[model samples]
Target: MDPLHYRAFTTPSGGGNPAGVVLDASGMTDARMQEIAADLGYSETAFLDPGDGGHFRIRYFSPLAEVDFCGHATVASAVALADRDGAEGHYVFHANVGPIPVEVHSTERGYAATLRSVVPSVAPLDALAELLRVLGWERGDLAPDLPVGVAFAGLSHPVLWAASRARLADLAYDFAAMKDLMIAQGWGTVSLLHRASPDLIHARNAFAVGGVVEDPATGAAAAALGGFLRAHGLLPADGRFTVMQGEDMGQPCRIEVDASGDGGVRVSGTAAPIPVA
Candidate 1:
């Protein structure tokens, strides 16, 4: 079957990250799924097998390989499910990482999805210098208060706080080298962010591991960042923040992150349908 296209985390300004959703991928082989994902050329695509009672099994694939968990694709798939079976507003997705509970809501703009991430954890990067050199960033470029570390929600991301928004905007790096490092470190993406205010943040994600230069909007990374903030006691009193991503790429996306609950970080975004060419 053909795939449905949607741009997840879209704002009024422009479409966000593009993802292909195969709503019914019951018997598709792994090689075929890989080929489809590569042909589609999105950062990631979701293959869903609907189970009984609002449960589904999902697998995520990038242009090059399969991913454990993907936030944007999950959001896209959940919204797609909402658009299809309006009767079910929530679903339980069994992914490689774990079960993800998705809550869908109807909004004026479109359908929105909130996925609670797997309980997150943070740890120091063993080879920070190598990653920094590959990213063209120095120790001084990072926020002194927020130490760089690897944060995992559903996927692992190297979370680094940019000392300033200017540092976040100037995104230049060696693609092959970045890819090698990411693969070696078992990282899905490198998250670079700047806190614009107490409740607002700006972010850029390097997705070399996925065979993409950058992810315009990354839900997993956003959730990871929220977990990192909660761990560091840096989040606002409500443990929520508004993330502004893809601004540098001119396809601005918005993500709402909440880590108030002790269980898992909640990441929310709206998805808009896009025509497949």
Candidate 2:
């Protein structure tokens, strides 16, 4: 099988989060896929099995384990599919999390995928102290503008809003220490963010739980961030915004976030193929 490597959320191929995409993973065992993912060593790899009609069965594997959903990989997979099949129309994906629908469109920039997340919910303050302790972040580092909470779009992520943009940029922590804490908490990723404006934000995702120090651009976390913003009334009705991530790492990904008054959030970005070894 030919596996495609892709960078999602950025127009340039070199930017965004890199993912391995196997468009046709027929007869591949879970163990085999897991091994491949571990060897590839991206934050996540996607295996897609085209089913009847336009439906597909998708699986996401991290280096250390399997995850319910992965946004960047999904975007990469969709773009890979469009590259072979042409860009246009909606593709349905059956993931461990649930059914996810992705719409593909051709734009002046390139082929972009807009993914609608599974039913999302925000957690009430339940494990704030433990979560903060894991990231080595003091409670005082939190911004009063945004609330601290757990948001789930597909996978679970603890959203921590930094008090300032500088705080978000200066990301340094004990990887193993944070990994142990994330394993205990069962978190998929940690969303560390700084609000640049009411509509624009900068984000960083620590993925030590996935055996990766960080993710360049995380679609799942972006979706969770949108939900968190809407739930806390941080977003205005009919608000549209962009999130700049991976810049600190020099990857520089851009994710477009749109919030509807009905409470559903849509995240859009481009996914370009990365060559697989």
lDDT of 2: 0.85
* Candidate 1 accuracy as TM-score: 0.98
Question: lDDT per residue, candidate 2, 1-277, as tens digits?
Answer: 8567888998554587899989899899999999999988889999998898779999999999998899999888888888888757689999998888998999876799998888678897477787677667788889985678889888889888899887888888888888887878778888899888887889899999899889999999888788888777888556677888998998999998876654446889987766545
lDDT score, candidate 1, position 26: 98
- Candidate 1 CA-lDDT value: 0.92
Error of 1 at 81 (Å): 1.1
What TM-score should be assigned to candidate 2? 0.94
Candidate 2, residue 220: the lDDT equals: 91
Candidate 1 lDDT over residue span 1-277, tens digit each:
7999999999977668999999999999999999999999999999999899889999999999999999999999999998887633889999999999999998878789999999999999887899899999999999997778899998889888899999999999999999999999999899989998979999999999899999999999999988988998889999999999999998899999999968789999999789755
Pairs in steric clash, model 2: 5-274, 6-274
Among the numbered candidates, top lDDT falls to 1
RMSD of candidate 1 to the truth, in angstroms, is 1.1
State which candidate has the highest TM-score: 1
